[model samples]
Target chain A: MNTIDHHWQRFTLRQKLSRYAVYLVLVLAFFQSIQSVEVIPEFLLDAPEQMGDMFSRMWPIDFAYYPVAVHDAMIETLNIATLGTLITLIFAIPLALMNASNIVNSAWCHWISRFFLVSSRSVNSLVWALLFVSIFGPGVIAGVLAIAFRSIGFVGKLLGEAIEEVNMGSIEALKATGASWMSILLKGYWPQVLPAFFSIVLFRWDINVRESAVLGLVGAGGIGVVLDDSMNLFQWDRVAMSLLAIFIIVILAEIVVVNIRKRLI
Target chain B: MAGIKSVQNRENPFKHNWFISAIWLLVVCYVLYTFNAMDLSWGRINEGFGHASNLLGRMIPPNFSRWSLLLSGLIESLEIAVISSICGIFISLFLGLFAARNMMPSWVSTPVRALIALCRTFHPVIIAILFVKSVGFGALAGILTLIVASIGFIAKLFAEAIEEISLKQVEAIRATGAGFASIILFSVMPQVFARFIGFSTYQLDSNLRNSTMVGIVGAGGLGGTLFSAFQRFDYDFVAAILIVIIALIMFGEFLSNIVRRIFR
Candidate 1:
């Protein structure tokens, strides 16, 4: 009896070469990043101590301060998120209609809507808040606008994708009936996209809540204002309270969104 | 005959869902309440539009005179994003395996799931602020904050990916009498490795977007420069910074898309 040699390898020579190249690039990138990211040794060494110190100060949470400042700020934060989501729906629906390739066949429309949506998404809410704060002078209006602007991109993009994914048969049926464009949109696409639309809005609203909570840091008005104020004052206890409030609101918002989305989709 | 007539008769094909109506009513009520509670006057909105146009006009031509300063801030953000993503992906690779219900017992997975959820609950900006307080600010704080975020997101997705894998394949690997680690390496890893790559690239993209802004809280990056630009009313420079950030995020998205295709 004779046995022939057997060999197995995960990749061909070309694949191996490419994989090696990728690894080499990653290694170089990592080293370049580490060198550029100057780490102060003292600060690095004291991080644990600093954490411990902060935690110590945060202990004995200022429950009393919650009612005084955090409560109203928290409520305002909720309002901002809700109002922002509602406003987003207004702008987003039209933009989404234009963006969807299935809905608007014009190449020009797609480009214009895509540009608007991408620009909206590219700028972070904080940056938007800063811009709006300058224009609106830092208040609920700025906060609401910032949230709405940022969300238009997200809500519009997802809604557009949902619109694109609808069943063509139903749409064709509506068209065959000699329905007008508006009627077809209302009778055909609307029902199909409604579930997706609800879920996306709820999801975006959930995110907007967390986002608005921090817009106050930029003076857009929300819990972040209370948080920034307490932090600046070195009122560690009050900061702790505000943080707690923010945490609870976030969890509650998550719960509500999950419940609603489950029932919806 | 009456029963047949009544059965065929319907006002609307769609049943009126009370749940949806309630949600709509609630939304309307909330918006109305918010308007009443907040002092968002129509006059203020009109005046705001004037200031907005003025601000937009000033931002034109996007001053690149301070190109060198802009370049440095952009580089720092890139470095923060790369470092944090690398560290975060590395951590999540292990954390995800532990959190997967199919791979681990209930006791092990439950606590890890809770930890991931806790990490996910807060916004990265809030986390960045806390890290700034603790780590005394710098790129270190940003890196830490983003690492937490990346872990929270990627690990959950990874665990979910793991949970959905075919257990039949795993049982087959076991039938061959392979060791635990070998079984994972041969059977489980093959199924999930592609998805893991996808998640890592997505995390990198997210971290890049987030790293650009963490500097707003002084954790480190373009944020501080951008904030200062705003303070000095350097609208042109601010516009330039924003342009750079948008370009950076879009580039990250493109890069991730390529990476995903490669892995796929």
Candidate 2:
């Protein structure tokens, strides 16, 4: 038994050492971060009590402010999402076409479009909102533009993939018929990708609805502005109301998108 | 005759459905009305172009004068992301198992699903605010907030992945009279392990992006530095921070790609 164990240990020595080394590094990093952040065990012990107190304050939401403050903001949020999705579709369609390897034969165009998609997607919508707020000044326009810019990558990437996955048989048939490039694209590729494109756009719209709600935190303008204001003023009841509204709207958007996608597919 | 009759019965492909058209019309009207109410006029838009150009001019020559401040914040953000992702992934593994309807009873899965849904309802920024208020501001709050966000996201995906796994292997393991833990270890995990790795890497990427933003609410990270710089109208500094953030995110994207490749 001792000889067998020794042989096994010798055989797996390198693999075991490398695995342990990786885990050791991760553990060290975790502890270092905890120390740097000064996370006190005593504070963690008291966290539940503090959270309970906060929840107690938030009970019985001030629904009275709903019509006055939240209603308009909710509408603005919806508009931002809808318009943003519309704008995203407008830009994403052409960009997706360019990015689709099957459609765009030019390697440079595909790479350029892919770069745009990746860079756009890499930055969070909040950052985009911040940039737009600086330029457009705090309003729904900034919110709309932020949502649009952030969603372009998501919409474009999905649509491009869908286009790439299109049936080549139909495309070749169109080509054999000596169809014009415009006709082949419109009659061949478009039909195949339309369902997926619509579904992707609707799904993005659902996400944008949730995202646009928070863009107002950076003064991009939406329901999040109301949320930020309530929090700053320590109006827990009003904050609760806004949160409730956001939750309901997000769930509703999800349901709507799911239904639409079901129909489209 | 049947093919000809089928062709004759087909509707004109170019004609739009009435129901869809009506929906489109209503949407258009709502958009127009919303635009009017928001006062998004062309004049306002034109004014924004000038502001954009002016801001762009100041943003040139990105400032790295506060290199130490930037470096510390970036490191802290990275730490928060990695720590939260590890913790979140660990917790989510169990939560996902409990929430998998195929593996668990409805009574168990229902409550777990509801908990996950509640976790997911609010944005991370809101959760970070709540954590900051309760726990006091710092990386701790940021970490807690992101852990919640990660669980909310990946747990659901993980549950779905588990549900979609083939039960044959599980049944075979059970037929051998293996204990629950052993059966799960031998059967359940292997099938979903690859997808779990994919989800974990994706969560890590998302957490990295979010860690930067949570600092805006004073939960601790580069966002705080960036926010203060913006408030001080330090556009050059802001530009530098933005550049660093973009680079960090791209690096994360690249890392996730490599991780996925390895798993594949």
Candidate 3:
């Protein structure tokens, strides 16, 4: 019995070593990558002091800025999110249908739709903003377009998956009743996916609110324009105020979205 | 049969809610207001399209003459992403365990949950700006920004995954008189490991994308190069950078897909 126990212990020890060996290799690779990035220890050590200094400079938040510039910018940001999400939903519904494998029987069509979604999603909204800013010559128009284009892929992809996952039984039942394709889609697919579609749109809007707030950095027009100006001018107090406003807005959006999703889903 | 037929006939197939319609009406009004505020016009749009065409014409045949600069920036971005993902995933693993309400006491879990939420509140761009200011700018700032973003994202999902795990296995391990560490290792880890892999790979993909953008704020990466090119009106170089960025993102997506497949 003692010999058997000793053998078991040795085997467990060997297993542990082998398991940790993989983590060891990963850690080694992490260190090698870190070297390329040149994250010096000295700079890391000084980071805290620099942070403290910056915080000190940012103290006494500029409440005066909030009533005028920040307020208008904040409203514009909200408008951007709302309108952008609405536009995305309009475009995404058709794209989602085209991309849904269950809806679109043709393989080529499905692949083409998927390709469009992937390419759109691959490019960041900021990059899109940059492109639109060049074309539109800066303003809320560019911001709105950037947000709408960026959101199409995300909304389309999720909605497509939801559409594909709808109960087939109901669809088949509608089809067997000699229903038209439009009726089948409306009566069969729409009801099942409406809940998910609403939730996705709301969630995307919440995200877009966060994104559009920063679109002004690229001259797309929003609160980010004020933020960019403040940061560049080294107006630390105003920067602090803007950041606080952003934090509050994001939290509020989160709460509203969660409550709505709960009620809907 | 007669009663059922009467009941079916009495029920409306479509139930319309006035409340929902009112909400939609409000939404439409708000959209119209926003449109009016933005001062959108067809003439401006047409002029914009002409400018767009000119820009596109210049962007054709991307110039890769500064290949070395682009290559180095791309490599740095890649490094920042990999390193941050490794660090973020490692830290999130432990934080996630602590944040799990089922695994830890409320007092312990609440603060960790709050920390995760706080991390998530600000965009990576805002955080990158802060890091760039404090850390004197470079790949280090970008890496730090992504690490915070990753923790905020993965920790929440990871904790939820842990909460969803069957406690029966954990209880059984405890019955053997195992220590906290041993039970966590032998039981809880097995259940959530696959999902943890999924979250980590997704985080890696996101970090890769974010690393490219952080450089726009001087945090270091391909974005810095791209931003400078745009400033110089080097549209060809900008086009080249955009092409590389798109390819990099797609490659990251492909790689993560394989990782997910293997794990799944």
Candidate 4:
């Protein structure tokens, strides 16, 4: 079914060499521009010390604000993540299937799906959060939407890849039984790839949890809102307390996700 | 071959399935619809672009008046990046190894693996903001943010590298009287060290890029200046700051390549 030709190897070598040359040219162009550019503002000598003093002054955090508001805000951050992940999951599953190379059974479908996934992933989530904040008027909803949108890109890409790795033999067998494409996918492909799909989803959920925490800085609500306010107010101690809560929540969430993942695998 | 042909025949088997095409078309349309609903109009985009261009124009001949300020901020950012990378690489080395299922017990590996996941859960900016808030704005917060980010990224890569290694050599080492530590040093390290180096260098490059951003959240570095520039609508200064950040990232990328080559 396959032919090993010497010419093919030569062609691949030529391709690799061209790629290397392009990389070299790009690097050279970048450096050339950098060298010519004027050094602006000039580097500060005592900036580090100033930064250090700022940090040292804020030492020994104030923990008295622990009763209800801070705790509730922390919970809201977690909820934002959970809701965002859930929404992305609903959107991603169908999108992933459409993108799945083997499942889609169409070259145009595959290429277009690939284009969408790649473009979505090219930008970082923070950029999306900023854009959403401007449009949605800075609230939990904006943060949730940003997280959900970003997670869709992440989950869709992984799930599509997972679908491609499924044992296609069963799919063929199902098709041979005169089953429809939908049935073959449901009965054959879904069960095999379900484990990996769920794992990726849960893993992304953990990531979204962390992301939602910071969405508030851009006005996408959560603990970040409080953190931002404290910073603006120059309340270093309050800032310290907020950070402690974030660290604790992240660590706790990490433990829970790890336990769940361990049990699943 | 005949059975395969029959299976293929039953499905639409068109080079482009109509259903998938419709789905994509619908998605694109939905995106467009959302844009319209959100009022992300051409006028707003045009106005933003106009402001951006004017800012870029002003950024030319960057103000060398604040040379000392710029220089010190650059130095602190570089330090924060380097220190965090060192801390991150150190933690990643041990955590990655311990988390590798093939290299360690389920009980031992699971916790370490979980820690890595937790480390990776947050964006560096969010984490930096947290640290700035918690630790009180400065290089320390920036460093902590980057260190956590590096650990998250490198540990995952390291664990995967370890998992992918040949078990035969590990087993051979185990058969010998070498202790677990020695076995890891000889067998596991040899196979994964190069990948670990690659990951470390990449993490360093990433940390450098991120260090500039942490300052935006008041964690330290040039970002604070940049953010203030943005707030003041000092487009020229903002442009100057952005150019410097870009240059820093490019330099980091170059340095990482050199490090990778040296290790290789």
Candidate 5:
């Protein structure tokens, strides 16, 4: 053992050389491809001319129609996010509790909950939206359901971990006092987990707002409908305007969410 | 008297015993009501399942007649995923570092953090739509969209990882007369590098999945192919594309594991 330890203390210079060789080859390959690929066409610079022609046809961003529809569309988007987050928040609590091995008190229940959570989280929100649109005929309801389903998995998993990390000592103490299981949870677990739960809710809300925009592509309803319309019609100006609007809304919401998160976390 | 008063206040603290119970009851009732309202009937569910099964049956023999097209789309999607991740991660490294409140000034961190939050505020699909509209239908739009999405997630997480790091090592390095850059390079980065790798790999996996879907918005990828298949009701092709997507994602997961191992 002593002789092996003595030999192990030595550093090999060859190892360094081999690692550098690998690094150099990888970097070289990256630059080589960059040099070889003619990504931009000869006519690429004419892109601005095309853009200018499109812009000239629909100049000024149509501010006259902004008040007529933007507010309603914006509200609809918010409503989708709200309803989705609300549904997820409601479904997630029990699932989170059930998924937490420390809370479930049964092996089968824990495994089942784990399976459910994993499967739910495996599919992305867009995929869920696509599936729901196929089944529910594409509207706000489908969008809400999609977001809600995705949120359930995310919130449940994170909240379950939070629940598990709560002080076991507190729960043991409550149980020692002859409290019921429900009472022990309400008193011992809820308060400790509430702050994290609130943060997750706000964070998810920020995400759902962005997701709700495109839900309309499959007819789930929102600015995505407008976006699709403009694109299909090749109304680049309208598309640009809508894009600008979405950016502003997202940035504003982001500001609010960041402020809230800072205060909480 | 003061002690007694405090105890009484603590014990009697406006017991909203019924309030909490009522909230829980309301939640349960709302769920049941919504479930029924959604018309998620057993018969309908069964019918849907049957239709899905029929679709799946047709999809078994995936016809790869457009092999070249599919391969080209797949390559573009991979390019989008890789290029976006590289660019996004490079930018995020600086943004994240700047946004770390403990390391940087409040004025610097605050705005950077806000920008990250904004980037993350929207889904990548919506972002793709916006980019496609601005940049026109192409891989450029897809790359830009994924980059925005990456910045949103990676920067926020990186900032968080940095904030959570022990400043003790950083302080020790500084005390040893190392420059600010050197101290960060040696002390701060080593602590967060593994976590940064973890976040990057996770983002890459997500980006790969997203790259396929960006085509739906005309940003460029297999998603456009998938969308057309869906529209044409080509269930077999859809199945084939789905299988391919799943394989790609699984491959990405394996790659991520390798990355994590290397970083570790």
Candidate 6:
């Protein structure tokens, strides 16, 4: 009697070898990173206790402190976020059009716009705020400019994608009529991209609100100024209050974005 | 008169909705009001430009004499990214399943969703600040902050991925008399694992960028050095550090692309 042989394997030999190699490399990297980390053993040991103590102090948050310093700063943060988003559209629109291959029709123009967008995104808002604060001598304007510069990449990238995805038939129809470039853009791309453009703008505005809340930490200006002052003064209660305000505002901004996007899109 | 009005309407193909127009009007007014309130006059902006150019002149020819110091900070940021991404991805696997509406009961998923939301609500820098206050400052705080950030983001994405998977696979597995856990292992996981890898790689990239700066809050990395250089008016050194950070992020982007290709 001859017995039938059966064989089953989830992966081939070469696949298994590659996966094992990847795993080996990952393990080596993990241990290497662990060795380089400089953790204070004592601090690590008492982390839970330290966390408890900090939480205890944070309790009984000073709600009374909100109106005194946080109120005006919160308003200024909203203004910075709003103004920054509005200003971003000014620079973002042209750059987005330039970056859209179908719209710009020049590889050189597209690359220039791409470089600017990438550099803008690579630099964090806080870093931009640091640079702006030095130039503006520390104020809301620094915060606003920081937000605008950081947002240009995000808004431009999304808007460019929307432009690229527009119905080509409409554009071709406009071109066939011997329409001017400006009119073709207005008649063809504008309607197709408007909804997406508004949605992207609103989404960015929401993010800008959260970012602006912390810009003051770098002395650019916002509720973060109050947060920094409170932290410095060891006023944990006031810090707690500031955190609460930021939390509420972020949630509210999300709701606003969702509602506006619903109607616009 | 009606014929003339109809022709005018035809001339303007786009109808002007008063509701949208009203909203636009309100936005314009609000912008003008806020502009006035910020007190950003032309003179101030002009003066700022003058200062900016002067500062720009100082940052030219970035100083890299302290290459060792810069290298150490860059390495620390990398380590923090790696460690946090690993731990965060590990934890999110469980949290994500618990939070998936289709996989778990509402009672379980609801609280998990809320917890994820809380983690996501604050910026990692803010979390790093709190961690610094508790952990007494170091890479540990930065790692913890990024872990929370990772879990917040990836868990939510994981849950959404799971929800979108075909339930027919689950039913097919269950029909074999397989238990709930086995069903999840055999069916649910295979479907979402690819997307989870994508999210993990993206999170790693994000964590790397964030780790470079969490040091600003004394969490530990290049950001502390950058902040100190800025305050010290060491413009050239700051420029050098910014260059290194951009290079690091670009390298991370390259690494992630390779990883995604391998998995795909």
Overall lDDT per candidate, in order of appearance: 0.91, 0.89, 0.90, 0.72, 0.77, 0.90
Q: Which pairs clash (backbone N, Cα, C closer than 3 Å) in model 6?
A: none
Task: Evaluate candidate 1 and give its CAPRI docking class based on DockQ.
Answer: medium
Q: Write the per-residue lDDT of candidate 5 for residues B77-142, one digit (tens) a residue.
A: 877777787788889999999999999999999999888877876678877765554567877778
TM-score of chain B of each: 0.92, 0.93, 0.93, 0.89, 0.87, 0.93
Q: What TM-score would every model get versus the actual structure?
A: 0.95, 0.92, 0.93, 0.61, 0.75, 0.94
* Model 1 per-residue lDDT at A235: 91
Q: Which residue pairs clash within candidate 5?
A: none
Please write out the lDDT profile of model 6 over residues A66-182, one tens digit for every residue. Answer: 889999999999999999999999999999999998888999999899888987887889899999998998899999999999999999999999999999998999899899999
How far does residue A205 in candidate 5 sit from its true spot (Å)? 1.6
Q: Which candidate do you rate higher for DockQ, 5 or 6? A: 6
User: Lowest-lDDT window of 10 residues in candidate 5 chain B?
Assistant: B5-14
TM-score of chain A of each: 0.94, 0.88, 0.89, 0.82, 0.79, 0.92
The residue-by-residue lDDT of candidate 1 on A15-99, one tens digit each, is 7676677668777888899987867878888888988999999999999997798999999999999899899999999999999
Ranking of all predicted structures according to lDDT, beginning with the best and ending with the worst: 1, 6, 3, 2, 5, 4
lDDT (tens digit, per residue) of candidate 5 on A1-265 = 5886665522266644554664475456445534442245433456567546766755767555456666567667777776788889778888899989888889888888776676566556766777666655566677778889978878898999999989898789889989898888888898789788878888888878888887878777767777778768877667667666777877778789989889877
lDDT winner among the candidates? 1
Looking at model 3, give its docking quality level.
Answer: medium
Tens-place lDDT digits, model 3, residues A116-206: 8887787788888888999999899899889999999999999999999999999999899999999999888998998999999999999
- Candidate 1 off by > 4 Å: A1-16, B1-11, B14-22
Off by over 4 Å in 3: A1-25, A40-42, B1-10, B15-18
Alpha-carbon RMSD to native, per candidate = 2.7, 3.8, 3.3, 10.9, 6.1, 3.1
TM-score of 5: 0.75
Q: Which has the greatest TM-score?
A: 1
lDDT-best of 1 and 2: 1
DockQ of each two-chain model: 0.71, 0.53, 0.58, 0.09, 0.25, 0.64
